[model samples]
Target chain A: MGQRLIARRQSLKYLGMLAGSVAGREFLAAWLPKSEKAEPIRPTESSYTPLFFEPEEFSAVEALTELIIPTDQSPGAKQAQVARYIDFLVSAASEYNPALQHEWTDGLQLLDRLSREKYQRSFHEISAREKQMLLEEMSLPEQDSGRTHPGYKFYRLLKEMTVEGFYTSQVGLIQVLEYKGLSALSEFPGCTHPEHQS
Target chain B: MGTHAAYDVIVVGSGAAGGIAAYVLTMKGLKVLCLEAGRMLDPSRDFFTHKFPYEWPYRGEGKPGQYGKLPQGMEWKIKEWTDHLYTIPAEDPYALAPGSKFTWTRLRAVGGRTNLWGRGCDRFGPLDFKPKSLQDGWGEDWPISYEDVEPYYDRVEQLIGVSGSSEEVYNTPSGKHLLPAFNPRCGEVLIRKGAVKLGIKVTPKPLAVLSRIYDNRPPCHYCGACNWGCDVGARYSSLDVLVPKLSRQKNFELRTNAPVHTILMDRSTGKARGVTYIDTRNGLEYEAYGKAVVLAASLVESIRILMNSRDREYPSGLANSSGTMGHYLMEHVAFNSIEGFFPQLAGRPTSNDDGPGESCLYIPRYNYGEKDRKYLRGWRFDFYTGCGMGPGPGARFPGFGSAYKKKIKELYPAAVQMGGYGEGLPFYWNYVEIDPGGLRDRFEIPQVRFHTTSEYDHAFAIRDEMYGQMEEILKASGAEIFPYEKESPYPLGSVTHEAGGCRMGNDSRTSVLDEWNRCHDVKNVLVVDAGCFVSHPEKQITHTIMALAYRASHHLAEEFRRGDV
Candidate 1:
């Protein structure tokens, strides 16, 4: 039985190596940087403070971004370094779009107030499934106040940023979906997939 | 003045054509001074290393009225449309009566629109240049034919590093391509299959974007932020190849933010003496003279400079003896089509992170031959497969809630659509006349009055036929069509692919410049831009424009050597 267990472990290890050789190596090569090269994400911190939200409320926003794009199959919002990006973007809010920054901050506080009234836990502490359910519930056009319910409007902003951040990131592009032709790929099949045929 | 300060040639606009002209001229042992109206922006400092559209000061757009177009929420994308290009405003924005709204987009910074352009480097065949003989009375023939430009085109394809296959039978001229053409992703492959099933000849197009390492430039990183600038020095922009090379030359001096106001002409001789321009930063005026002056400052601005000269010899304008200073403006009439929930995209996470919308395949003009069609001219079609579903004005129409998200996921992958890039006829009515009422920009400079797309009906008919062809492909693909309103605005120069403002011709009476783009009246002044294009060929004009600049400057050097200038 111990020998059988060791053999099983060996098989698993071989499979992992094979998988890594085929796809993981290319992915890791893209993910890992050489010593000479600079990191895609810069080290400078963002100047955009959470305008309407307190420190606690801003944490909820960060958590919410992660929840929407979880770090599972690929680098989610957190791994793609989206929070840093959002911070850099928000700090320069007065210059780009003031209303957008206000809406983002206000939405966080409103969501926290609504959450406190319902389940009694902070948004970040909530279960993943529960958070997803709440998001799904509030994502309605009727719930959007356009101005009054800032949280509802803020949810929309989060959605835009989540999708934008995910799709634009290297992990979301290559890992989630196979996007091979940065420079021409050797053997790209142009719309000839048998399953794709109408 | 001695030949101490001034160079043998003074080239305006450090964009694609101007950069190439400077490189060629400087390489030929002539000193060249290249002036750019915008600031000299470095890519490392100005572009990339930022996130979100709101990270920019102008929100990635240029300063208002800098483009001279009207202000609208939709126009915000005009700024993000290109990093180096400026959005030319439509102060006296002309409409196509009730139905037409055109987008004339331009880049005004260091590299110009080549930074934002799709990099679809298509060639003009013998038919496009000699259109008058091929299909007479529709449009005039190019002053020179494809054969004349063929050698230069081959040379440019080599220097710039064009990648593609040569199906020598098509309208696009075959060449000795530097690299093999890029193949489409799986989604694009599906579209190609559908097109083939529909009898559409869709092939991988020759693109300026590199597939392999060529000309010492790196291959594309596939970052997909192509409409923004390339940070990796992959795409063929002036910054990557031309300007950097030109900067290395001891004879070349490029000064940016100097907006040329007028051409300084010798009153008695009626010759172009120099140019008077305002420094955009300091707002101070400076005059720079040269033995020969080449105007590569686009179609409209190039002509506007000459008109503002207002010399005594030619009262109407400097080179107004032909009475064709600003005539025959043309833009590509892009007819777009969209459909949702493609079957192929179902349950698949596809990578939409590719280069800009420069398509892999092109549906060559089908109605070019002697066929019974309502439209006089033919239009080309290009298709793109996009990923990511957005919740905007079109969000509610598709559906709502979780189903919508699921539908979006399903639809995003399957979403492949085609658009018609139709040709606009060069009519005398659709022209740019100077604003006599003295309408000024935000910089308080006088704005140009462009009256374009007068022949909208003719242009629309051609577009409609192309749309019908798209419908046929969709049907052949067996994709379920989600219907939307076909209410696009008229060809209002929105794309900023502005051409034919100062047309080239053999006859000086009907055109602004001669075959060499030389002002018929002025011996030393040469215009090398869309201003010199008599007809707008089906292909993008940048390559042709650069080639012309090279040819024109080469001619100027030979002339100067022969004591002609």
Candidate 2:
């Protein structure tokens, strides 16, 4: 695929030379020299130290994100280091609004309290099955009776951030989701399905 | 204050209008100096196109609460992925009237907002030129007709390399394009058929992005990051296309980081001598002399400069003799959108759908000839698919774990959306003025306070009609549409198609600029941005802004030759 792209680019360069106006060719010479092939992205080992969450809270976050997107048929959130990304984001956000950091910290405490009440252990000490059950309960909508769970809103926020971090990561997009875009295409082959065209 | 080198013409704000004005004037052998408020950017170095989210600190999801603290002017800049293309909010600020809200999306770079534009280049038809007089009496008609600007449009379209297919729609005037149109996606093909079944005309969207290698610029590589700045110059931008060509000329000179404070006037002759500007780098003031001064500093910014140009002869403002300098503000008001999931394409594999940000299918103003509608003016519909590559509403799905991931994958390729860009009538109540309550920019110039009244009964009515049409089309396409009740029109100026602060007309009492975009009070000063728009059509205003700038500059050059100044 890389070789094909390079060949396509070279042909485009030839075509541009043939059809380009004198002024267009001049501007092209000035701007097109840096159009070299981009470097391939390699997975780097993360040396992230938790800035926002405590050590216990960071462990719970890692376990929770893994459960949310476990290593099933494809690589998941744990491989993407979603928890570390979330910590980095929240830590930087403290300068803009410290309330966000407080909310995250308090939410972690709430999860721990719920785990202690249900299974006589901290959230990080709980088993994966128990953690999944607790998360399921938290995902339940508020009933018509107006009774709400304690960690429901926090679950929603954590889930949103985890999804954002995971899907945007190289592991989730390139490996799990198989997102194939942002590359040079000679032409967009749009709408191959004939049935779609009535 | 030291005086800089003088030129025959000094064009302010090196955006679309200023760039085109400088290009046309300098091509005619007149010495020109272009003043830009922001610094220059090398797109290959500055644009974040094709960069993965992992490359960013927050993985493209900006830092939490960072957006909340940003000023209203910097809302668009809060996106960490493309923040480099925007101006710093603290350096340039504007105010809103009490109980009013407006989003003045601006870029202070050499290319202005062109660096971050959607690149949907559409032409205004004869009806759009005089919608009030021809169709309904919502506002004053443009003094110049479509025929007067048609030739200039042809020239500009060929120069910029617009890619589009001709259609039979009368409201959207056809132009000669340099390349053929982009092919429609599967979802767009479905929607086009549905639109055709409903007797709605769907034509190829005219885009400033290149289809073939027109000029020396390479064709689009389908990166889908046009808004982040086109690194390859596949899309049209003043910095890449116009400025570089003109900068090569010996007669042309460009001064970046020079924000014009006011248009300097010779009091005795009652003509614009040049301009006084601040060198933003060193905090020093300087003056550049010119025979003519063209103000293309955007709509609101240009008006702010004119309002700040207060003197003994023109106390209210430099061009405020009509007392209508900042009156009749307008923007495309109705932006109603609807999205749905198609079952047939639900599990289809994703390809290189990352073309230009613009879609292939465009539904022109269909209600132009209809007289029995609830609204006075009309709206255009743009159907698109695979335009958004990021996580969508699926990210907000209930629950988590592997089932959640499966649901997102299923819904990803099935997504399709249609949005409307409707016309807004110019109103006296929706105007901008220098804030008297003492809010100022970094340069200590008083910031503009915008006020938009709720005179949008017609706009709301058109939105309802748009929703009904969207529902019919989505239903016909065999898709499960999102609930219509949840959708609402965006606020005023949210579309960033604001116009009509310094409107052009034949009568000086009702307009700030004459028919040729020249100030009736200050003859040598011309406002060439969208500020000179008389009526805000639903179409994108950049094409008309460029065409009008070319037309006005042509006349200015002729007038100079004739010694009219």
Each model's TM-score, in the order given? 0.75, 0.91
Q: CA lDDT of B162 in candidate 2?
A: 92
- Predicted candidate 2 versus true structure: per-residue lDDT over B327-431, tens digit per residue: 888877555356556767766665555666567777888875676777777788876664245443234344466656665666667767677777888888888
Please give the range of 10 consecutive residues that has the lowest summed lDDT in model 2 chain B: B387-396
Cα lDDT of model 2 by residue, A1-198, tens digit: 001111111111121121124443343333222321211112323465698877778877887777666666667777888889888878897777787688799999999999999999988787777887887677654111133688877876677677767877888777766767777788887887778776
lDDT of each: 0.61, 0.75
iRMS (Å) per candidate: 19.9, 17.6
True contacts kept of 2: 0.44
Best by TM-score: 2
Once superposed on the true structure, which residue ranges of model 2 sit more than 4 Å away at CA? A1-49, A142-147, B1-5, B67-78, B88-91, B453-455, B484-488
Off by over 4 Å in 1: A1-198, B1-5, B49-104, B352-357, B370-372, B386-399, B441-444
Candidate 2 clashing pairs? none
